[model samples]
Structure formats: structure tokens, C-alpha cells
Target: MIVNLSKVISELESGSRPKGGVKDGVGSIASLGAEHLESNGGFNFKKVKYVPDEFFRSQSKGIIRSNDILIVKDGATTAKVSFVDDNFPFKEASINEHLFRIKVNTELAIPKFVFWYLFSNYGKDQVLSDFRGATVGGISRAFVDKTQIPLYSLNEQKRMVKLLDRADAFRQKRKQAIDLLDEYLKSVFLEMFGNISFNPHGFNIGKIADLVSEVKYGTSAPAIEKGKYPYLRMNNITYSGEMDISNLKYIDLAEKDEGKYLAREGDLLFNRTNSKELVGKTAVYNFTIPMAIAGYLIRVRTNEKALPEYISGYLNSLHGKQTLMAMCKSIIGMANINAKELQSIKILMPPVNLQEEYSKKIKKVHNLKQKMLNQSEELDNQFQALMQKLFS
Candidate 1:
């Protein structure tokens, strides 16, 4: 189980190698430098940004080439590493000085296997452990060359890659399904609610504040690990409106705080603070949890007349989203939506029955969405497991 990576493969030791880091500019590799690097890409560069030499001197920039395995040196994204495939635009790429590219001996070690190891949890931990800095962390080149990595035979690596490829394919399909469902829901909403300009016969324009009973902000309670109560931070919710329980945090709260923050079934959680694209994102709880909402979110409880499904769908609609965006005030780093602003936004009023009808359509769409997302998650898990089996 304990394998010495150096013994099994050759190490592309760093020193006198080109060094570079992320920059806020775009240019070609030859003109930029011998080293080419990208800050973030999905293992391919259908769209990617290149680092500028002005930020890093010509001598300090690290050398990169096609088929190189990039290692993010520092930052919260340290664990993310990708192999430079043929599709990359640059003949050579440079990395953020915080990142280092691993040029593995292809004959001794499989590039895909090396990429998988760098992406694994264990590898992430290893990279984090080597990080040296106070405010901004960074991994040194010497650290990477000395770090141990496992190696597998070419045939075994190929087999593992095949399995992983299949899993990735499945994940892609799931993502497509989710996207399709989203489009379907949008079409259904327009069909039922009409364009924002008008509504179905007899429907009237309604102020959102009047329709909802109470709009309250979440708690700013102290958080603790493994506490009695869970802390639902805004990050716990995804842009796609799914609950990510894996990274859940907890807090210890007294009875008063518990009563205030405890999320019950039918409650709607809205992300009030985030990027402009995600500021107005919303999710409804169809489940129960003893948790306190963080300051970054708001909890809205609808009156008996208003339905959770109807509100959730409406909030996700184009008109609703536009209204929320209009209310948003953006600061340097984040955009914020307040309760007052949210309430003042306008929504079209349909009859209670019509609202219920829209709710049912959303439910059906949500079912298909959930299935697709579950499949995507399953595929992602399987791919991760395959990486471990192949490299470790």
C-alpha cells in the first residue's frame, strides 16, 4: 500500500525551470514565454485565460508543454490538477507561481493516473501539508519533486481510464438531462404564466410583499464542529438549487437560537449574499433538519394562501430573477439582497388554482431534475473511486 513514487518513476525536479503564476491577461504561449499556464479549466481549454509575463519575470516563469500535469500550488483550489491534453491552445503553458506542473515520465507513469492522484483527497492533503505561507499559501517546486506518488502499469492505467471515461460520460449525460429539465420548466412557466407583460385571463399583478406573511433574516450564531445543531451556511446551497450535505458545518445553539434557526419542512431558504449570478438563488426544504441558518441566507415562510412550490418556481423564473437582480446592490466582491428589497419586488397573481397548477408542473419537472442530478453525482463518485483504484 505504501509506494515510493520516486523509485517507480522519474521526477521532473524543479530549478532553472520556467516559473509563472496566474495573471489577469491573455496571450499566446510563444510570445508569453516557454511556460504556459491557466488558472482554471475543466481539464480542457475550450475557454481559458493565460498568465502574463509582466506579473512574473521571464526567468521565474515555469516551463510547460503539452501533456504536462499541472498542480495548483496554493489557494483553496490546491487540490485541483489537470493534464494538458492536445486540445490546449498553447504549445507550452505556464502556471500560477502558486501552481506547479508535473512532467511525468510517460513511459514509467501514466499521465491520467498521475492526474487522478493529484486530484484525490489524499493528494490534496499532501499538497496542503507542504503549503508554506501565512496569508497566501504556496507550494514550492522542491516540495513537488520530493513528494512521493504511486505508479501503475500502462495496461492497468488504461483499463482504469476506460472505466473513468465511462463514468464521466454518464455524468455528462446527467448534466444534460438536468439542463433539459430546466429548459422544460422555463417553457412550462411561460405557457402557464404568460410572458411577464401579461398573465392568463383574470390574473392580476401582485406585490410580493403582500403575498408573503413574514420574511426574516438568518442567524449569525457561533459555529462549532460536531455540535448538536447543524449550521446551514449559504455555501451549503448550490447554484443549481441542490443541498450539498457533504460540506455541512455545525453549531451549538441555546433553545432561543434553536427556535429561530431550526429549519422545518416547507421552509424556503434563499441565498441573500453571493455573486451576482447566484445572489437570488432559492431552494425549498422538503426534509427536516435541526439547523440554524447563517447570516448569508434568509428564511421565508409563506402564508397558507401562497404555496411553497409556486413561490419556488416563480422565484426561479425570468421575471422574478430580473426583479431580484434589479434590487441587488453589488459591492467589490459580493452582491447582497435584503428582505425589504425582496418583498417590494412584483409578481403576477394568478388564481389559487392556477398557482397550484404551476406547482404541480414544477414538481414533475423537479422529479426528473433530481433523477438526473443523482445520476450525475453517482458518476462523479464512481470516477473518483476508479482514480483511487488505478493510482493507489
Candidate 2:
């Protein structure tokens, strides 16, 4: 049955509207933000926050108990969903101003079942439709209340959750395999190239300009939600030198930008503007699809002397990032290591043949990694399909 969230949820409350009233540095309370919501479920303690326990104890902020569904209500990450299940660690946690708490009435709905629904495509579409604002959008309490949820019998809901949980487990294992292969590649790079910091191989060193044909900035095109061309943003490149394509955005390229900021396969992307901590992130354009990059990024086209993988890996390496960060200029609020400075940075140049050999070896592992990625993509599509069918 299709029913408003107000029907299924006993209460819907927004967290503190303007957060940060609570003092930090207090270990007793763990403050929860939209970032805590992980893909699988629950909180990610890897990047958690601590607030004063007094606030949580006094019930000043919205304290989330087990089985509460958390939804983000503001900014770019608006509409993100998380289920705070009993297994979530921490004796107490409170939501910040940007989140909302939805307590399901156990008599009417199952928390995990409802969580999987809200995490589905249908749920996100509904949330996005309700969002209001010109710049940074927001979800109001009334809008969320008016949001509809598809419900089923309790037994049917339980069975659906059980099946979805099993599917998620398989995806988790696939992710683990990919992580292990990545680790193996790291080891191989270390064994062949040695530490970039130590330079034990005595390779000849020269400015990066000698190894690249062009270092050009990307397009400053206005982006759209739906477009003909896939686009890369600063956030698409991870600090570890891998592309996170799961959340890629698209923009219709203008006539002038069609070929101006186009990224070809084997091109290396460098984030030229960001916070000091995340600036200088680099990733290879390994995907075959034609895509455009944002102005905040720089594209480096390497000469025959250097492979794109080699250059990308080198820049992503601990030493490579440190070198870039050291040379960047922080002005206004963004950091930049423009084309000129990037070309001047000293780089270790080993024999191109050695880099080719390493690339060939890594290709075998990448093939398997690609297979896993395909399988995971298929699984996600199937999961969403089933979810939509059940809910619709």
C-alpha cells in the first residue's frame, strides 16, 4: 500500500536547525552527521565526531535510538538515508541540524525494511522532488511528512529484508576482493619502483615538463543534472589515485567545450583546486567513455617517455601528493598548483620499458577488477529492480 511517511512513522523530527551549539572535545558524546551514513548501513566510525554527553543526556539535541531511520535534509548531500539499527555501536548518538529522525511505529512498519526502501531509487526520487531551494536545497519537515512510502505485510517485509541483506553480503565480498587486488598492485609498485621518497634505484630525475606534452586546465562549463556528456569533478578523484565513479555527474557540453575539455583514455586528471588536505588528488582516465572535466581540474598528457599509469600512480603516491601540496599556492579559499608550477615539479624518470612491463603485469589484475566492477554494477541494478518491484 502507498501511504504518507506520517502514516508509517509515529514521529518525524528535525535535528537542531543551526547546529554547533554543543561544544566539541568532549569524549562522552558521539555526534552523528550525514557523513556517518555508510552505503551498507549504520555509521562509519572511521570518520566520527564527539560532542558533550551532557547534551545527549539532557535530550537537548535529537538523540537517535536503535531502529531510527536518519535522513539528510540539507545541502548537496540532501536526501541521503541511513538506518540506525541496534547493532550500531555507541551507547548514545545525536543527529546534527542537517539530518532528520524518522521513528517507525513498529506496529505499522519494520525499520530495516523501511530503510531499504528509502535507500532505493524510488525513495531518492521522491525526496528530490520534495526538496526546495535555489542554491543549497533543503527538505522541510512538512515535505518529508507528505512523502509516501510503499508498505507490505510484516511477514513480507521481513522476507524482503532477509533477501536484500544476503545480496548486500555478496556485494561486500566482491568489494573485499577488489580491495585485496588493489593492495597487491601497491605491493607490486613498491617492489618494482621502490619508494618514490627514497629513490633507491638512482633513476634520472627531471622536471615533469620533460615527461609531458601538455598540462592544460579543464573547462569551466556550467553543469546540468541531465546531459549528453559524463563529467568529472574534483570529488570524482580519490586521494589514493582511484576514480570513484559511483557518484559521477553529467553535463551537456557546449559547442566550444565539446573538444576543449574533452578527456581521452590514458589521460591523467589532477585536482588543482580544493582544501589543502584534498588538493592535488590525481586519477587516470581509464574509462573508455568520452567525458569532460571541470575547471578545477588539470589534464596532463604524457609523452611516449612516460605512461599515464606511471604518472598517475606517481602523483597519487604519498611522495607525489606531498610534492604537489608543498608547491601549491593557497589564495582566497582554494589551493592551486597550476600548469606552470606542475611542469616545474621534479619527477623521477625510470626507463619507459620498465613502466610498460609493470603496466602489463597490473593489466591482468585490472581485468579481474573490471569483472568484479561489472558484476557489482549488475548486482546493484538487480537489487534496485527488485526493490522497485516490491515497493511499487
Candidate number with greatest lDDT: 2
Model 1, position 55: C-alpha lDDT score? 34
Worst 10 residues of 2 by lDDT: 17-26
Q: Which stretches of candidate 2 lie over 4 Å from their true place?
A: 17-28, 39-46, 52-59, 86-89, 150-153, 200-210, 219-265, 286-294, 303-305, 319-333, 344-347
Among all windows of ten consecutive residues in candidate 1, which has the lowest summed lDDT? 32-41
- Best candidate (score: TM-score): 2
Q: Write the per-residue lDDT of candidate 2 for residues 59-134, one digit (tens) a residue.
A: 6547888888998888878888888766888877788777888888989889888888888989888877788898
TM-score of each: 0.74, 0.80
Question: What is candidate 1's local distance difference test score?
Answer: 0.67
TM-score of 2: 0.80
Task: Write one digit per residue (lDDT tens) for candidate 1, span 1-392.
Answer: 44544443454423232245333455444222112233222454433455454432464445666766766666666546666668766665555444565676777767766665666666666656667877877666555545567655778767776776576666667776778887788778778777556665546777667678777788887688788877888888776565666687888778876767777777888899998867988887666656678888888888766776666677787877777778899999799998887777777777778778887777777777777777777776776676666556
